[model samples]
Target: PRLLKAIEQRMEQAQLRYEISGQPARVFSEFLYSTLKTWSRPRRVIAKAEHIGKANPRFVVTSLPQFDVDWKDDVTVLDAKHLYEKVYCARGEMENRIKEQQLDLFADRTSTHWLKSNQLRLWLASMGYVLLNEVRRIGLKGTKLAGAYCGTIREKLLKIGARISISASRSRYRPRIRGRSCSVWSGSGSEFLKHRPISLTPLI
Candidate 1:
C-alpha cells in the first residue's frame, strides 16, 4: 500500500510537469523498505517515475552501496541514471550474444542420450562460433559482413555453388549468380582464397 501510494503521487507530479513543459517528465528516487513476511530486513529500492503518454514507473532493488547515500542534487540523479542504464540494460546485449550462438551455431542441440557426445557437440559448436567470430573481428575487417552474424556469413560466402572448369593453360571459376552481372575476379587459382576484393557484392 505504501509503495502504491508513492508511485501514484509521483505519477501525478510527473503528469503535471509534462502538461506544463509539453515533454515527458521523469523522477528518480530511492528508499529503504522491507517485505511484510519474506525479507523483513530493509533493502534499498530505486524507482524511476515517469509519464510519457501514461504512468510508467519502474523499480529496481539493489545492494549497491553507492545508491545508499541520499540523492538530493543533479549530480546524484546523473550517477543513478548512469548506474541504472549501464548496470541493468547491459543484460540485453549479453542476451543478444547468447541468442546469436543458439540460433546461428545450433548451440542448443543437446538431445542425445549420451552425455559425452552431447558435451562434445556443444564444445565443438562453441569453438566454431568463436572461430567465425574472430574471423569477422580480424579477417573480415572493413567488410560488409564484419558485423554480421555467423549464419549470414555462411550464406553469403561459404555456401557459394560454383561450377568450375579447368584447362592445362589456365583455370576459369565461373559462378552463375542471381540478379545482374558481377565483375569476374580473374586471377590464378591460388589467389582466389588469398585475396578478396573490397566490394561485398555477393558471389552468389
Candidate 2:
C-alpha cells in the first residue's frame, strides 16, 4: 500500500516533469508517512521516483529523526538523496559481505557426520572470515589485495608454495614466486603478519 502511494506520487511527478521539461525526468523526494494499521507511529520514509524509459519508484522506511535533535554527527543526519544512495546502498553491501563469507570463505560447508563437528566447522569458517576482514581493514590498506575477496586472497597470496628448512636454532623459508622476484612478495605492504595464539575471552 505504501509502495503504491509512492508509485502514484512518482507518476504525478513524472507527468509534471514531462509537461515542464518536454521530456521525462527523474524526480526524488522523501516523505514522513505511516500506515495506520501497520505502523504504531509516523516514521521517516524515503522515496525515489526515477524514470529513464520506465517508472522506477523505490521506498525505504527509517527510524532516523530528521529535525528532532541537534545535528552533531554528520552520519546521523542525511538528505533524502544521500540517505537512499549511501545508507540504503550500504545495507545492500552488507548482504554482499555475508554472501562472500558463505560462498567465498566456505561458511556453508557443513557435510560432517557429527553435529558438533559441523558447528565447529561453521564457527572456524566464520572466524576465518572475520580475521580476513580485519586483515583487509587494518593491513591491506594500499596493496593489490585490499579489495580482493577472501577466496581470491587465499588463492593469490596464501596458496603460494614455499620451501622451509628447520635447524636446531632457527627455521628458514624460501618462498616460491612464479617468474617474479621475492621482494615483490615480502615487502611493499605485502608482508604477511605473524599470528600469535591467544586465550579466548568471553564477550560481556
Candidate 3:
C-alpha cells in the first residue's frame, strides 16, 4: 500500500499515467506470515504441527526475491530485496548512524523502554531502507529503466527519467519517473517523499 500510494501521488504530481497489476497485499501478507512462523514458541509450533501433521522449520530472513514474477514488455519490475539491501548497505555505516539518530529521537525520553522498542525499531527500518536503496541503485546502474525490470530479447532498454516536483499545498516534494513516455510511473518517492532514491537509470 505504501509503495502503491507513492506511485499514485507521483503520477498526480508529475502528470503521468500509470497502473499496477497483481495482488501485492496478499503476497506481502503471506510473506509476513511466513516470517512470523519463525517466532512461534515450541508449544505453539507443536499445536500447528498437530493441526497440519507436518511443517518446515521457519527462517527469519527477508523473502523479497520470492516476489519476482514475469510481466509484459511495457511493465517494469521492482525487486523489493534489491531496494532493501541497497539502502542498508549504502553507507556501510548504517548501524552507527541508526544509533546516532535514535539517540536524538529519544533524547527526552526518561525510560529505556521506548529506546528498546519504538526508537530502536524506527532506526532498524532506516537500516533496511539503506540496504534497499543500495540494491536498486547498483542493480539498475547503467541499465535502461525497462531493462531493470523487463526481460527483452532485443537487449534494448527503455528510456527513463526522474524529475522532482513541488506540492505547494502539502509542502512536500516527490520524484517522478516514467519508463518510456507511454510506460507507467515508478519510484520510492511515490508514497513517501522522504524516501528518496539513492540512484536511478534507464535500464538498458
Candidate 4:
C-alpha cells in the first residue's frame, strides 16, 4: 500500500515527462531517497512512471549518490531518466541479445557430462553466433533477411533445399527454390556468392 501510494503521489506531482524514442509510452521520472527496514541508510531511488493507456510505475534503488555531486573533467553525471532509460534499458537489450543467442544458436545446450567439454561447446556456440552476425552485417545488407533473426536466416537460407553433384574437378549446387524465394535468390544471391570461390551456373 505504501509503495502504491508513493507511486501515485509521484505520478500526481510529476514535473519531468518525456516520450521514449521508438516507444509509444510516455515516461515520468523523479528522484527520491528512501530506506527499507533492512537497510542501514536511505538510498537514492529513481521512480519511473510509464503511461500508455494505464499507469505502470517502477522504482530502482541505487548506491550512487544524488545527481548533484560535482563531477571531474572527464566524468559524466547521470540523471534519473538517463540512468533508467539509457543504462538500465541498454542492460535489458543486452539480456535480449543473450536470449537470442541461447534460443537461435543453441547456446543453452550443455548436455556434455564433462565441465570442460561444456565450456568448449558454449565457446563454439558463441563463435558461431559471432560469425553469423558478421554474415548478416556484411552479406545480407539491403535484403529482406538483413534484419531477420538467426533462426529465420538458418531456415530460409542455410537450410535451403538443393541438389548437389560432386565430380573429380568441381561440385555443383542446383537450388530447388521456386516462386518468390527463387526471385529473391536470383536478384541478390549471385552478388552474395561472388565473394566466395563457388561458381553459380545458370540452369537451362
Candidate 5:
C-alpha cells in the first residue's frame, strides 16, 4: 500500500500513467488488517510474469503498474535490448522454474489463464525496465540524455537536427550534422555503435 501510494504521488508530479496488478489492494490489506494476522508472517504472493514478446502477436510489455491509469500520448516504446533483459530473460527464468518444479503461482489448465499469465509477465517486465531506466537516468544526472531508451548512451551530448522524408514503401531520414565523424573513446567503443546509429543526439 505504501509503495503504491508513493508511486501514485510521484506519478501526479511526473504525470506518469500506471496500473496495478498481481492482486487487489483490498485482498493484500485483508491479511494485515487484524493484529493477529499482522503478528503472523504473511504468505508470499508468488506471481510470475513471462514475456512472450515477438513470439506472441500482442503488444510488448515493459513495466508494472500500481493503479489503473491512462497512458500518455508521448511515451516511446523501450529499446529491444532493454526489453530482452527486462522481459524475455526474466520470463525465461520463471518458465524454467515452472517446468522444473510445477510451482508456478499463476498457471492454470485453461487457455485464458495461460494468456493472462503471459500478458501479466510482459507488463511486469516493462515495469522493471522502466524502473531500472529511471534509476539510471537519475544516477547519470548532468550527462547527455538522462534516460536509456534502447540505444547507446551518449558520453558527450551533441547538437544535431533532423528531417523525415517518406515515399511509398520507403522512408529516408536526414539529420543535419554539426560535427565531424569522430572516434568514441568511452566504453565498448565501436561495439556499441555496431548495432546502433553512430550519430549522437543531445537531449537539451
Candidate 6:
C-alpha cells in the first residue's frame, strides 16, 4: 500500500516510457533517495511503474552511485531508468531461469533424509535444465518451439506415446499417433529423434 501510494503520486506527474516488457507494457522509472533510522546515510531507490489495463508498480534499492562515468565511447553512464530496466530486468530473467529449473526439472524435490543426496538431486536437475536449454538453443532453433519453455518442450516433445521393439541386433521405435498428428511426428519428430540422444549406444 505504501509502495502503491508512492507510485500513484509519481504517476500523477508526467513520466516517460523508457522500457517495454515481454508483455509490451511500457515502464516508467524514477530514482528516489531515502534514509531510514537504521541506515547511516541516504540510499538510492528505483521505482518502476507500469500501466497496462491497470497499475503495476515495482521498486528496487541499490548502493550503486549515480555518476556520468562512461565505460566506452559507445557506452554511456546508466541513468535511473536504464539501470532499472537493464540491471533489474536482467536479474528478473535470472529468476525466471531459476523458476524453470525448479519447476520443470524438479530441482526443489529435496525430500531425501541425507542432505548430500538432496544436494545431488538438485545438482542433477540443474544440469538437466542446462543441457535441455542448450538443446533448445541449438536444435530447436527456427522451429515452432524455439521460444517455448522447458515444461512445454518436455510435455510436447519428450512425453509422447511410442512403441519400442528391441532385438539382439538393433532397436526400433514407432510413435503412437491419433490421427493427422502422425504427420507432425513424421517430419520434425523424426528429425528431432535423429539428432537427440535416444539410446546410450556408443558411436564408433
Best by lDDT: 2
Q: Estimate TM-scores for all models.
A: 0.52, 0.54, 0.18, 0.66, 0.19, 0.64
lDDT of 2 by residue, 1-204 (tens): 656675686767876786677776756677778786988888888887766556767788887656434566434557787778878889899999989999988888999899999999889999999888877765565667678788876776678889999999999997677632344345424434554457899998
Model 5 stretches astray by more than 4 angstroms:
1-113, 145-147, 151-204
lDDT of 3 by residue, 103-164 (tens): 53332244456546756666665565454444335434433442231223112223333455
Off by over 4 Å in 3: 1-113, 143-204
Give the worst 10-residue stretch by lDDT in candidate 2: 179-188
In terms of TM-score, how similar is model 1 to the real structure? Answer: 0.52
lDDT of each: 0.72, 0.74, 0.35, 0.72, 0.38, 0.71
Work out candidate 4's RMSD over C-alphas.
8.0
Q: Give candidate 6 misplaced runs (Cα > 4 Å).
A: 1-27, 33-42, 67-76, 166-171, 177-204
What is the per-residue lDDT of model 5 for residues 1-204, given as tens digits with 9 covering 90 to 100?
533342343333222211233321211111111134443543312122222221111123234332333466555443443345565679987676444222222222234557777776656555544543443444334434343332233223233456899989999887554332232223223343444546888989
| Models ranked on TM-score | 4, 6, 2, 1, 5, 3
How much is 185 displaced in model 1, in angstroms?
A: 12
Q: Which residue pairs overlap in candidate 4's backbone?
A: none
Residue-level lDDT of model 4, residues 9-104, one tens digit each, is 555433234233334354445556555677776667777866544567788777764444445545556777888888778998899879878999
lDDT of 4 at 179: 75
Runs in model 1 with CA error above 4 Å?
1-29, 33-42, 47-58, 67-79, 139-146, 166-204
Two-way lDDT contest, 1 vs 6, winner: 1
Query: Cα RMSD (Å) per model?
Result: 9.9, 7.9, 22.8, 8.0, 21.0, 6.4
